[model samples]
Target: MEQDLWSVEFTSLADAIRSGRVTSTELTELMLARIAAFDGRLHSYIAVAPDLARAAARAADAEIAQGHWRGPLHGVPMAVKDVFYTKDIRTGFGSSIYDDFEAPYESTATARLRAAGAVMLGKLTATEGVYAGYHPSITEPVNPFGDEHWTGNSSSGSGVAVTSGLAYGTLGTDTGGSIRLPSACCGLTGIKPTWGRVSRHGVFPLAESLDHVGPMARSARDAAALLGAIAGADPDDPTAASVPVHDYLAQIDAGIAGVTIGIDRDFIAAKATPEVAASIETVIPILEQLGARFVPATFPETREILYGWHTECSVEAALAHRATFPGRRAEYGERLSALLDHGAQVTAFELAEAQRARRAFNGAVAAMFAPIDLFLVPALPVAGPTLAHMATLGPDPDGILAVGPFNAPFDICGYPTITVPCGANGAGIPIAFQLAGKPFSEALLCRAAHAWQGVTDWHRRRPEL
Candidate 1:
């Protein structure tokens, strides 16, 4: 309404259009102009669907004119990770393998978002297949928090777009923390919804069992609005849950007066870095003030999770691209290429064993949640690594643990995990807290997250860059 469109949350933008303060066309043009002016340096988008977006915006404005606003996303502009099969638009998986591949059909997610009256800005760049960590050859988007720092991979470019104001929100796939990793690194709010809660029909996969498509946004409310638009059962994906969608934004505002939060003493005292430990610990007291309860807990089967996830991820990935990897081994970078080879070598016996272990772990995890409404951990024990280092060799453990082990287990467990910036370290890099929950518990997580956000300004803070 005030024309501070870039800074306004999706909720406010919807209110503006609903009140006749701004038109969808106006916001669409603002985004396009910003993209033209800024994306040359950020490299956030692989493609800009200008004509298509304008048409959608105009259609939305006409709907508003006809007294038929769809909802919160009615005039909001959003983007997707480039790996989605966006009809008539170049939907590359940040790989040279299918660089020219364009889809004749729309993905269920894309089509639904359009039906909800959301406008598409374009396709954001991602790591190869939007799967693994760090793909520099396809795009070189800098993290919006700081140009000097590296954006987290896979959804790296999508993170840049949101933080830099190139787009309001974008869909990102999280296999092992792609969405939460970048959201944490860029100081945004992100949710990796419970597996099967969101559709993956037209999107590319990193791991079939682990991959989750969700929203990354400047605010939790914005994410909830986007989530509402894109979530639901899809006929295209047999795995899509038959659960009915609820008003996520309204749920978030309901607060966490009675939520039971579990803080694992071992994980907090063990795997966390000083920053991560500090960030997560701070959340307990804050949420307590909001009337959320804290319980100390542990996982008896924690030992089996990491190894099983590694075996499962590599194996699934290898099977997915078995034909391509052996023939085009030379095209891939070092880490992923090697992982693919090893994935192919994983025996069926080993996979079966992993599945058995996973069931045991899931049962233990479910038992853990039985005493608590949500579980809290440091999203990753460490902050983002230097792309130069991760690209050349791999991750270097500093003062932090290889904390990514948490992300994989949730994917295997098919539960929901949301990560939000708690605060930044002394160096100004963001630190995140992860909230894990039982299946289809996104509403509970969002409600709690909204309450936490109300007390903290971390979500509202922006980078000087």
Candidate 2:
């Protein structure tokens, strides 16, 4: 059977539009139809903007017909995590409290995509306030691969939408592991850019200092396309770095020849499940065939840094929700309430000390990258857990702690990282490994990931659903 347009990468979809092989309206309608048919099982979308998407697609088609192609993403259909504020659209933040809240203006990330002529499919489901876990009151998105498997939190719907062909790509935030976790579990490529690489304006705050906005897509090149559209300094977000955005697609196909990929074999052997460890081990030879080399490297002791991450994130989250929590506290799920209550108790001095430790940890990790171009690690220590298993852990579970050992350190260190599907386990669940680079090294990361995808078909494998 011919693959659906929704399963193709955004780059391919854009090409089809420009070549007059398809209209943006046709593509948008196909995606909407897919959502109508299958999202019932995936539960990936919180809401579908049929009228808005159709209107936008018509506008895009008119522009392309007039030879006014905006760029690669022009007319491509995509969705965003519900945490992003979309003007006149219900920006639920995956919480019942804000379930009816619609933003007056668009988020910088979504606005940039819209400006690029991308058609919005709708808002994807997200954790409450894009925090540690799924919102208790909201319906959790099941993995497209299997309902028993985990979809990965916070950005769960974003992952499922991309993996199951509901959307070509979607935007997800990563304060800890939100982006990469879902990518790993759902078998997609996800980039968590260096801190401030993308604007956070109009995004619900999880942990302001640690928060990052990035893209999840079918391939590294697709992710690069999305990154190019959304990345850049935003005046509205004072924290958005003034760093010049690179043409991420420029070097994406450039093979990683002579590139030194650092691997901490001991770390993987000790921390990852045997299957995940073996899967990452398989990537070494494949990349070596593409002219890349590997060397031994060590990661900084993550225990202290992990603790500091919890402290800083909890305190910041508590402050972000202070006015609402304990005031209308019953409206929040028990786990989120507990987290807020815990954050309320963190002393001022403790927060100060955590910041100090965070800097030290960043410095230590930065030093590791000095001798290597990129460091590789498993995206998750184990295969994704089932929703039932996660349910037993309760709401407000320490998601960063539970899933972030391999993921959170980069957020703390503020380095760019990308997760690519390496392989799958016996049960058909996806397994992935991450590649971390120096700050603002998104181009290099994409290049390396693209090279791996070229040699392996892991990323191309989709769920039967």
Candidate 3:
């Protein structure tokens, strides 16, 4: 195995372990060391379970030596956002209220990954209750690309860990752009699988209807491997879709020949900054060269989606935190506290109207996808906004709305969307675009993204540590 194991792609690491080129213990130790050396500055982890990871790695090695390889993830070390329940490990939902709390059982996603023979590295950092900001006591993960850039929302740690090579891959939950935002900002590939596509049984909720659990990785194929391990129906979660899971990597190299990718040039131009818009424009010619077809597809009316997303997310979040919120309001952060307060005050009629609008938007999106296999857009309006800029947008409704146009609509529709690194700005911060598909179209998204990655080296570029 190479000495620079941290920079290797997830699939390559798994292959090395499977072929006896490296042992799980070796990989685990290297990752643990890297986390120790780098995480102090990055703050990408909430807790690291080195003992547990070693035990799991040893077991995996013993099994593989006996010719019992479980699958692609066998003996591979990975981590999850702290919101997922990990038995015997502190599962802080990034809140001071749960500072000393540990889960009695494991989340379905973690259990499934363990069952697939993957080694658990530890828990990654998450925003307070997976909301807009970190709890007062928690340190926000810094963007590895530049300390000044915003790390995105709740899944910032997941993005930081993978981009910084602290973990091979990670799980990130998306409600409104949590996964895609960080992936875009950090220059990683992320999948926001359709709602219910992955079981969320033991994961803390931001918004029940809007929340989605998915994988963040350096490449699309790596994401497919992670997604395959944790996806499918779970008896513990009735909301987990009963649909049969697709072998995401089976057709990953099939090429995008003749695949219709809908492009609303005006839509992207109107919503994106010049840097972002130009970067997205460059991606079209590359995809076209790979035999993909593009058509001028108009985006659906989206002004209502921003407001509906706020209403629906607020109400559901209020329900999720009902047991401890008002009683322990002081323990919460300002952003989450305000969210809960607004949610508490929303009248039934307002929530109902929000739902109505969401449904109409979903229908419009479905109709728009009827003629195209995928819809293309910038992952965020700006290439990469600075933390200073994001701070000002905290209380500005218009500013808040500016960033949601490319993100919230898909969450509202429960559609599958993937973000791939397309280009970068002058300062070398990442710029990316999104490809969204109809529900359960994750395989298509992965295939398209993988094809893009194969032809470009944008995803392979790393930040200097």
Candidate 4:
């Protein structure tokens, strides 16, 4: 197989290397070539570590050449979200405030990726502090999927990198739909594993309790591969879950048989656009043909759950930037500055009410999961809305909520969610269907996503842009 690295999946690349079809150095060089060739137009890469990546890729090549194989992620050419520190890399969280802040050590997630033998393509751009959907203040990485469309933030660059073929996949931190929102916009698959499933040690946090570090990739299978590489308990991150490592890749292709999938119709019905609605409507037969049982349900507290999410994000972000906010409140985007201000003014009583809403909402969602392996909903309310449009909330009153209302509760409740491409809109940008499962039920979630992908062409389609 003489495919360029842009179109290569890491698993396929590794297997080929194992069988002498290709070498890791060749694969890595292909990626480096692609990045060097394409990233100038996309601006997807904030930095390209040619020296470091070649070294790691060469080592992977040497290991395989010597009959030593590291792991599933071994030899994969991947990019890091700037929020996660790579020891020698100049780590900036897309904010000038952190422009020169270099860590003497590495993030646990970064360490894990290194241990798995993954090669870094350097840090990708992000919105300032991973805040708004757009960050022109720093990098101008275009969507490169649909006319420079804004993949929702804060982990904006991760989506751009993956979709633009800058890397096989990239890491992203999610507090409120950062991962899935961009995935939907950029036509990629992203997972916000139940909050603690992955370590947050090296990542800059938006909300400590709500932030999750996960992958955005070309397919659910790829996302699963990357997830397995980095997820586990990290002693440095006290909040990391102490659970059995899931064989995320093995869980795919269970055929969707005997799986009870729930269609959250009310939620789907309310936010879906004509195109998004049609895309999701088309999935019914796909699931039915797979012998999947479908249940229709709704969470009573969906609205309240969202309000609480914003409250939590703002409050936590404000707390983290206590010093910065006071010095130059102008440094933040309008949306974020206003939010942090409101969060600062939030009364204890209001916080308590939001907490109560969160509790009630989590209970409702958990109860909904009682009989279903996954809940399926459109990943975005509308597919790939223009970057300029999403930045200002445009004419859409519902805003990012349209694409990710189901996501925040997943964050608050710490549930597993994977957004896979379902279909594309008229403009040909891909739309997605999200599979959300009970907490730590990623095993079941991956199985169902794998099944869904079996008969669908969504995963096969790529943006022409």
Q: Pick the candidate with the highest lDDT.
A: 3
Model 2, 217-328: lDDT tens digits are 9999999999999999999999999999999998788788998989988878777778778878888888889988899998878777788888888888898997788798
RMSD, every candidate, angstroms: 2.5, 1.6, 1.2, 2.1
Q: Can you tell me which runs of candidate 3 are displaced by over 4 Å?
A: 1-3, 396-399
10 residues in a row with least lDDT, candidate 3: 393-402
Give per-residue CA lDDT, model 4, range 1-465, as digits (tens).
Answer: 334556645665667767656766776787788778777777777778889888988888888778888866787888888889888777878876676787878998888888888888799888777765444477567766666466667667788778766688889988878898878777787898997999998788778878999988887788888888889898988999999888888767656787787886766667667777778888888888888888887655577778777777778888988888857876666656766787798888888888888888778778888877778877777766776555666322145454566667688888889888887766666778888877787777777777777777677665553
Q: Give the number of the best model, judged by TM-score.
A: 3
Candidate 4 residue-wise lDDT at 263: 82
**lDDT of candidate 4 at residue 65, scale 0 to 100:** 77
Off by over 4 Å in 1: 1-3, 133-136, 300-303, 384-403
Candidate 3, overall lDDT? Answer: 0.89
Q: Return the clash pairs for model 1, or none.
A: none
Predictions in order: lDDT:
0.79, 0.87, 0.89, 0.77
lDDT of 3 at 396: 24
Comparison by lDDT, 1 against 3, better one: 3
Ranking by TM-score: 3, 2, 4, 1
TM-score of each: 0.94, 0.97, 0.98, 0.94
